[model samples]
Target: MPATGEKVAALGHRYAILLSTFIGLLLISNIVAVKLISAGPLIVDGGVFLFPLVYIVGDVLAEVYGWKASRRAIITGFLLSALASLTIWVVQLSPAAPGWENQDAFEAVLGFVPRIVLASLTAFFVGQLVNAWVLVRLRERTSGRFLRTRLIGSTLIGQLVDTVVFCTIAFYGEISGWDFIGYVALGYAIKCLAEVVLLPVTTRVIARVRAAEAAAIL
Candidate 1:
């Protein structure tokens, strides 16, 4: 429970929440992405469900908090993701307690895959920063008009980069041919579609966050 006026580092209370939300979602997405699932005809990772929301919150951060703040959050997420992978790897190496039979299950679920981690970290860092930068630049150029254009456009470009980086590093050798291409194509399209579909909700969240930040400042 955050007490009234509680603050974390330089970010004020209200803004800190957004940063925390972004990092939390990023970490969870990576962990759950191991399972491949079928959503109608589209086959995707478990992360696909939660990961798009990562971008929605990211949009809020960029649109409401500005580039410097958004960049700080992005860097934080990247570093913490590496730390998580390291921690998981170390845990896997540690000798299990005698008679602990769940080690296999634990490893199966949470084992640290270096390639996947590298790909996720690289893609997230690049994708999110690109998302933030594009939004901020568009905001500046348009003087903040056309909110839908900014959100969806940035997501299109950012998701594209993210999908490419992640698929290449994580699955390039493991999955070849059209499977690789479809993996990238489907993930990218779904991510972009999520942004476009949720534009209204995203815009409202941004507005509300902006208002809250303004109120907190007073």
Candidate 2:
């Protein structure tokens, strides 16, 4: 184990990167969430599809850095997202310009439902932590041989939890029950496929980062 100061310093470096990625993911996911499209039989929402990269980045952090580091990143993302939501709510309540006829439109776009925010925070927190834990444990178990299995498999399970919980809570009254299930399943599959397709790139980046870290240690 590293000495206390060394461990703190190491964590600071790790969190700097992790936190940056976390905030980026949170902001992008929420900003683009409104765009919904159809991809064959699937309904692809911008946030649902793109948000998996957050888990991918989390996986990379956990696999290389360890679970503790990953958890900090996950929690940091959650807190930041909450902060963003709160700020948006506050702004929406503030007075608009006298000539601003678009206040309603602005509220329609930016105002978040309480249920939706709660579901998002809860699901992301649980799913990401679960993903990181599963990835790290599987890596340890397999001696790091089945990289794809760990990455994709953990993502599959994690995204399922995220999709189901978030969709159920966010759209419970807005959508039919069947439609809710369909959206959740569609989102989960899209996210899993995305992570699988990005596996090669992820592997390469992880390797480079690990090498750099090792070199710095040396």
Candidate 3:
């Protein structure tokens, strides 16, 4: 329940950008995730490139803006992702024009988009909330000390939950037994490692955001 005039105002510019980027990453990841790419010996979805960053951004939001703001962004991304899927479904099902010979191609690429988006939204909503809650809870417990430990711990749990939920929903029956296990296992490992590796950058971004907000108050 948000007032139309003040909805965007509530987010402000800096936090608004973070929210928009979070949603953008979700939409783009879902769109490109249709393709399963070969990264060396590993078979992964195109989303592998962007999903970790999405989580990192989530961490930033939670770390800087706290739980309420983080939850709002997560919910917004979930709803927008659903909207994107619905939009694609409508376009894909519409009658094609005479020169439009790529209907099959369109359907081929965007046909199963709804399912993937469903899985993504579900996983994102659950995973991000858990991550944000854990982060905020830890901040409460530690008085904001141990930033690295909090982030790594939350990412470890959140990514595992997200990976399992997303992979099982998106690729369970689509891939074979061993492949499914590998996909889930590797994706989880990679997401955690990616966040861990980028922890310094993420922490810096969070710190800057907090500092800027504090300066704005003066």
Candidate 4:
């Protein structure tokens, strides 16, 4: 039989994979957020598709690994995002080769404004922490039953914070007041709908991860 320490180490290894996925989604979402996409009458930033996955992953972490682990992952993502933004800013400022003419394009894609970056990091930190914290509390209240309730409940609140904070900070002065309200309302609704739609998949992933962790101890 494996020692207690070994069992704990194995669990950490499994959690590390989830943590990596969470961070990858965050970094990619930030980069892609530069573009605004329209679907029918709804318009949203390009990150709309990818950013919600971070919260889904966070839900999994909280459900399977618990709040402490989720908190660590959230903080790590925050730091890494800051580092990524700083690195991109540095690269954007560096002089390009004499013949290189794509600097403008590159900046357009990756050159995040300082204000936007600040807004993203702040919103992400608050949103993810809220997700993890609320899920954990719900888990305790429900004694781990009704997975959908916790998932949807936490996501609703978390995404609301995320949408409001991010849009207000990033576009408050740039867009019209009505547009800002629309962005917040639309973004929150879309993100919550995504959680509801993906609930089955999220439940399966959580089950599989919990099973794997259980098997690791045996």
**TM-scores for all predictions:** 0.91, 0.87, 0.90, 0.93
Please tell me which predicted candidate would have the highest TM-score against the true structure. Answer: 4
C-alpha displacement of 46 in model 4, angstroms?
Answer: 1.7
Full-model lDDT for every candidate: 0.88, 0.80, 0.85, 0.90
Model 2 Cα RMSD, Å?
2.9
- The reply for model 3, stretches above 4 Å from the true place, is 1-11, 173-179
TM-score, cand. 2 = 0.87
Q: Per-residue alpha-carbon lDDT of model 1 for 19-69, expressed as tens digits?
A: 899889888988898898987887888897789999999999899889999
Off by over 4 Å in 2: 1-15, 38-42, 173-177
Model 3 lDDT, residue 36, Cα: 86
lDDT of 4 by residue, 121-180 (tens): 999999999989999999999999989988999998898888888888988889877877
- The residue-by-residue lDDT of candidate 2 on 1-218, one tens digit each, is 43466655664685587669866987789777867777786666678656877877887788878889888888888888889889988989999989888879978888867887898888898889888888888988999888877888888888888888888888888888787777677777778888888999888878876776665454
Error of 4 at 23 (Å): 0.8
Tell me which of candidates 2 and 3 scores higher on lDDT.
Answer: 3
Q: Distance (Å) between predicted and true CA of 205, model 2?
A: 1.1
* lDDT for 153 (candidate 1): 88
The local lDDT score (0 to 100) that residue 143 gets in candidate 3 is 99
Backbone clash pairs for candidate 3 read: none
lDDT of 1 at 46: 86
For model 2, the run of ten residues with the poorest summed lDDT:
1-10
Summed over model 3, clashes come to 0
Worst 10 residues of 3 by lDDT: 1-10
